[model samples]
Target: MKKRPVKAAMIGLGWWGRKMVAVAKGAADDLEVVSAVEPYGDTAAAFCKENDIRFFSDYSAALADLEVEAVILATPHDLHEEQIDLAVKAGKHIFCEKPLALTREGAVRAVKACESHGLVLGMGHERRFEPPVAQMLAAAADGSLGRILQIEANFSHDKFLSLDPSNWRLNASHAPAAGMTATGIHLTDLAVKLLGPARDVRVVCENLASSFPQGDTLSAHVRFKDGGTAYVSATLVTPFVSRFAVFGTKGWIDIRDKAHVESPDGWVVTKTSTGMPIEVSHVPPAEPVRDNLVAFARAVRGETEYPIKGSEMVENIALLEAIIASAQNGQVVTVA
Candidate 1:
């Protein structure tokens, strides 16, 4: 018997939207994008015509289609809440980009809407699907790393000041906080995923570059529920660097760059107190976009569980709120 492919629609055909379209096309056997909604008529019309798919200037038209089982949102950070709510009401599964929503309340409402409607909501924390990260987490769970003691995560780039100020990312009205919320939030979310919900968070923001109206850099200190602490540093004013290291009571793991670790095959595992090295072969996963898209397709088909949960997004947003509050108040804020 022949099986039907999952019909999908994509809202927003901007930079990220194009990349998502490519991924969905690559997974065409399992999923197909039948409709795309973009406000830019020329771009949306051209893309839809080239791909032989339906195109609309408004998302409501796409959402009204009965064949569209899922909708991928690649719009700006501020629009996620309303779009998710509309999709949920229309009974469509949702795949949303990172951070989920601008505020904690918005994220909570999105989660609640999806839950009430019995729809699967997937967030774009794609790094969790990376093979090296997956292995490190598994080893930690198996007691290879013993009790985790500390974590250090860093993600920084020089693009903030270099990019045009007209970009929505530079506008705090659209994104709220600065570099940490835009970039470091991923590291913060990843840390929480590896560890647990952060118990407390303290943050500081500084205007290291004059390009932004507000601060262009942010640093945060976090304490997790298990007594483990983490430091996240991010900036748009500095050179590029991305890394994450975890120290446990028995040993540690380090992930450098995006794919490479520090030990053999770019992964390093060591005994905590003794400083003795442990042997492990680590291979990076395929590109995260492909991995996450495929995972979402499988989840839609009930073949696997969604890698990122809606409740976890609620926590991530809550922690982000606390970080911003701590930065603004110059005091540590406890996660509620």
Candidate 2:
């Protein structure tokens, strides 16, 4: 007997919202987007009409539907806490976009609410589903790279230079923290997933370009609980580059991009002890969105664990709070 697909409602019709729709369509066997809520009436209507999905301007209308078992939030960062609370209260599972909340307290509250309700809460740290990143995490856990000593992850994009100042991403009130929250959160979350928790964090933020009212670049130095150290650099001052380097006592792994770790030419892995280089050849996994949505749907169906947990999201938010505090105080802040 075939089980029915989990029905999902996506909130928000921005860039990420459209991408989520595409992913849900590709994985329609396991999940189906029954409806969507978008404040922008015209855009939402057009999208729904084209995709043959129901659309509503009010979130309550969408949430009122008993057929929708899960909600995918693609709204602005500032709205996550309140919306998640509402979804949890409504007994709907949730898949929220990253940097779960702007503040530590908000994140904790959301997690507590979901836990109290016994609902599945998943965060969108989709980079973890990428082939190279997944492989690296597995190897690190298996001690393929002995005692990871240091990690450096960087993400940079110059899109802000051309973006409209009125966009939500450029507004500090909406984004809270600038470069780090907007782009670097992915790397920070990845570091935490691979190296456990970060203990002491020192951050520096600079307003390199005045295109947006907020700072354009942020650099964070973090020490892990396992005595490992990492640096996360995020900036809108350069062309787009997404790279991560993990160093350990025995070897190191370098990932050029999250999506193409397994190119036809293969990835390069080098051993520090033997000084031998090996080309790792494996097919890249499916698109991260597909994997992320599938994982969330499976969790909803009781077929698997959620790819990311609410507790992990809270921890990441705590780290972000520490980073922001350090940037503001101009000193190192200790993580709790």
Off by over 4 Å in 2: 258-275, 278-285
Q: What's the lDDT of the predicted structure labeled candidate 1?
A: 0.77
Off by over 4 Å in 1: 258-275, 278-285
Give me candidate 2's TM-score against the actual structure: 0.92
Clashing pairs in 1: 250-272, 261-266, 263-267, 263-268
lDDT of 1 at 33: 86
Q: What tens digits encode model 2's per-residue C-alpha lDDT throughout 216-291?
A: 7788999988788889988877877777888888788877653321122323333343377655544444577777
Task: Give the alpha carbon lDDT tens digit for every residue of 1-336 in model 1.
Answer: 665667989898976787778777777777788989998647779988888889889999988999999999988888898899889989999999877876679889998988788788887776676666776778778888788888888877776665678877787767655676667778877887767888998888777666575477788899988788999987777776777788887777777653221111333322233466554444533666666777887888888888787777888888888887776755889987
